[model samples]
Target: MKRYLAYYNENHCENRNYDVVIVGAGIGGLYTSLMLPKNLKIAVLSKKDIYDSDSCMAQGGIAASIQDDNRKLHVEDTINAGCYVNNLEAVNTLVDESEEAIESLIKLGVNFDRDLKGNFYRSFEGNHSIPRILHVNGDSTGKGIMDALIKEVKNAPNIEVIPNVFALDIIEEDNKCNGIVAYYKDKFVYFKSRQCVMASGGIGQLFSKTTNADILTGDGIAMAIRANVELDNMEYIQFHPTAFYSQDFDNKLFLISEAVRGEGAMLRNSSGKRFMKKYDNRMELAPRDIVARAISHEIDKSNSNCVYLDATMYNRDFLKNRFNKIYSECKNNGLQIEKDYIPVIPAEHYFMGGIKVDLYSRTNMTNLYAVGECACTGVHGANRLASNSLIEAVVFGKRAAGDISKRINYDFEDNISTINTRNNPPNKGRQEFDVDFLKLRIDLKKLMDSSVGIIRNIDKLQNALNFVDEVLFKIENLKFNSVLDAEVYNMYLVARSIIESILNTKDSIGSNYVEEYSRHSVV
Candidate 1:
């Protein structure tokens, strides 16, 4: 088989073989590269710039069971917040390895915030029994972690970082993935590897308003579905309830980290009343699903476009010092968070469901692994406890690399054959008439927002299913003029998959709710 790589800097295709091809150069991908065998030939692929990932924009911290925190209590809180449907094995893996992951981050030069007493300054979040979230770079925890990981990855040898490279589809040989078709610069190329890991993150861009970056177009979820991978709990998408709201659509729903509520911030409506108390005993610090549901209900009942997150009620000096990022962003957007009431709304943020993976980050298929937001290890279940996402990414990314290193070495196999491989015929790549997929994607997004989001009823879900089915048919036959077409095609696949998963579910749990059958028992 011939390998191809197209570079815009030089119009030449280079054929090569790598031991492992890791998709999406986010924190997970970066960490995976670092943990791989020192001699392994690894290629890190990305559709755009490497740093433009959902992980890089995370303003919150990583939740863990460090210090004297009780592991049993953390486990119970995670399971409870997951609506008791989380995979026990996956939860155990996360909680058991969390401390090690934190320690690893610290060793990698991630400076988590500490107090004057020289101890880790932890913060509380929704559904946690203890204050164990270790923050870094103040309100820029994601950037801090990503910065450290990226810097280390850049200095590492045997890792080929390929940015602006998009993995369109996986090439399967006899039910096993042999390689992948990647579009780089302006041409499609094939990359064969012994192992592949998908760390491509979530599909937040599908929504009109989200905190995700432009690259999070559901590529990982859509690619797995195309390869017939097992996906679980996709309907349990977590929408952060307190996204900063601005009139400009540029950054309309910037996420106000759950850490704020974890640190005693209040959620109030126009009546100046604390509404979360009416829903859950934990009040403003309840699980994200409960708080988001309450906020959505209030927004609908009051016929308002957004809600309010009152930070002024807290100590202004402390708030300013702690949340400088949020404070400055709000200030730049013409809102004084300390003096003026900051407008907020729920934004479709993280997807809890993805390619189902085991503790080793191995998917059902051979030689294929998934980590980070792209894989549903079942730790998040229906709703993810705040700050657990970052921790999960690093923990599993390390495990995936460790798992792969034990079996594979870093040398290229010269005698590899491609007799079983079949390539799409020339001129079959994408045509000009395939742009209708974009319009169809817009329709799906509107349908998802109106019907499949927040509170769901039988009628609306049925309507959403119908709309998605029609769109999926269009996507199946659609050609592509550009990568946007590819993105739309994948978006349709993910939306349909989420709809199908929702339909198969019999009971209301966490983010997935069907009012008429909410009480239905599967047994």
Candidate 2:
């Protein structure tokens, strides 16, 4: 591993340069940085603490066709789950490289759980035909993986992990990404880089309740929109069918991993009767889109806030051993997994649309790349298959790193000549009107949840778009002093994009269920 030297300029706001600047310190950013040539100077930025990412919140394991399953079957399952709208090349790339990604993680010291025979323990998830998902610490897969990757990152001399930094915008000149202007250490700073990787995760925070971490405010997608980069599939937002229902209605919801259902937990109505059989023949093993919609429909019909997931039939010891975190959370919340039914509801979970990128994770703009939830590689087209997100992050993250390394020294000086050197300062003025960000955030969440959520219609979509447009107008006029203000602005942009996308897409497919289109006609 070679190390590159870095120097700071006299101006405090300018010239903190790096060979590569990766926005968002989730699995994608961390894995990409680790995979990059160690000779290049890399900077990984996180809006909050590095560990406070959606990746760390993932309870289910990464999916891969590593055991009795084959890559072809995995690819077919992914495409089928995506309503056959997935980009074939990207799907192939993801499936073909999944084993390698898993192996790389192992080499980096990710301690995946193993059985008595020293074989990796694999579990099943919704929509998967085979038991291909791998876990760690029974169910704390994300935490285990992140702990290892974080340790590896800290030991890498060429990588710098900067926390409490907000990337405001991607700085582009002459149609090429030069770097980013971000708020760091209570001041705005320009980080010049040869390449920029946008791995800033998803937009789950826009909704009132989500499995995503609070830090996920669609920063990467919003920045890409600002940079005039291509975005796609914005209408496709995956709602997990079984997030724990709480009366507090907090933005961060605890996800009851789909593996629970895969392991024989049954979705039942308030009357303690099984319900999924009516929705789909696959029952609890149906794809996430179907399951989520079923739950939403059940709630609407029953006029109840949530349905129940009955896991009492499973052995208590097995339940505790396999889903210790979920069991403990339920116990702490006054619902024991072994004796009581866990209340569950559908909540916004994953975004399948974002800054559009090619198979190599290269965005439309030069010197820019995106991976993870922030990048639409078309691998998870209309809806994502369960447990595929973690593997997608590792696969595309490595591809982005590899592609960037190959093109790292491609006459950057010549390209620099085409860029205009201009210093854009951050807005420092306070607004005359006091905007209630909390109220606006709540309003936005309700608006999206009611209109553009699991089910959609033309009228509701239009109403949501109109509301978002009104908020965007106000956000543009307001001046911000903190990163929180910027986050609100970004949320407005992302929410607007999603509403607009739903309006533009005419057909119902996968998670995007438009009322105008017949389900049989599309699905």
lDDT of 1 by residue, 68-156 (tens): 88988888999888889998888888999999999998899999999999999998989888898888867899999989988888888
Which residue pairs in candidate 1 have backbone atoms (N, alpha carbon, C) closer than 3 angstroms, thus clashing? none
lDDT of 2 by residue, 258-290 (tens): 999989889998777898888889999898999
The Cα error of candidate 2 at residue 440, in Å, is 1.5
Candidate 2 to native Cα RMSD, angstroms: 4.5
Worst 10 residues of 2 by lDDT: 1-10
Segments of candidate 2 deviating more than 4 angstroms? 1-12, 414-431, 520-523
Pairs in clash, predicted candidate 2: none
Which regions of candidate 1 fall more than 4 Å away from where they truly are? 1-14, 409-434, 519-523
TM-score of each: 0.93, 0.94
Candidate 1 yields a Cα-based lDDT of 0.80
Name the best candidate (by lDDT).
Answer: 2
